[model samples]
Target: MRQTELSITVPATANLGAGLPGATLSRRLGMVTVRDSRPINPNTWTVTVTSTPFITGAGSATQTIPTSRVSYWSGPAVRHTGGGNLAPGQPTSAQAQTLTVPRIAFRKTSGNANNRVSWEPTLVIAIPSGAVTGLYRGTVTHSVS
Candidate 1:
């Protein structure tokens, strides 16, 4: 049997949100789905995530979201029952997974459309009391192998 690589799907960009100084804010990064398309008995894979510090004002002002403040959970799952048959439902409540820079987002044990998995990651950040209120931007990159 031949093993195949894992594939991950995510939005090109997402808004973590905006808020007043000293205010805590949160935003869902939307559904991130992954699949191991390998045609072997046990195709295992892992995913990792990292991000750049949020920056604004000519890239001088900056802030970083602590990895502890980011978390993810399995979202609704779509399953392929059989020949063109599909089913969708919410799975067991998976505990929130804290994110660390270059940390593993998730792992897959096998490959199959029926075994596809997805997650919704949330970023929670607190604006410093002295934060110069303005628009800040950052990037969250995910890698799979």
Candidate 2:
């Protein structure tokens, strides 16, 4: 299973309150979950934010009020690896996989439509040679703003 790439899915829903009457809140939601593959295998992971304030609409303020790009997520991939770590100014031993959301319908502030977002993430975990053996733990955040 080392070379066989695995697949994971991350779902997202946009919610806006009191948004501009003519503006749209629809934005693409993407996510990537990271895991550690370091114990006797690996077990550590990290989430890094590359960009924020993604926009998608007509009013120009599309996704600004309360919008943000997804960092990395968590998945079963962490069970096999310890998810690499960044010490001081060094390269990480492991990497956090990325999840991309190419499509999502934003909930305009005026529209009383359901705008709650929830998603399940899938991650690829790699096992290193000198990993330790132990119980690892982590968490998954559904929203940012």
Best by the TM-score measure: 1
Model 1, residue 131: C-alpha shift (Å): 1.4
- Please give, for residues 1-145, the per-residue lDDT of candidate 2 as tens digits: 4432222334444232222333332222344332222223222222322223333343143222222222232222222222232221112213332324321111111212112222223222222222233222222333221
- Residue 102, candidate 2: Cα error in Å is 18
- What are the Cα lDDT values of the candidates? 0.58, 0.26
Against the true structure, candidate 1 reaches a TM-score of 0.68
Clashing pairs in 1: none
Off by over 4 Å in 2: 1-112
Off by over 4 Å in 1: 1-4, 61-100, 109-114
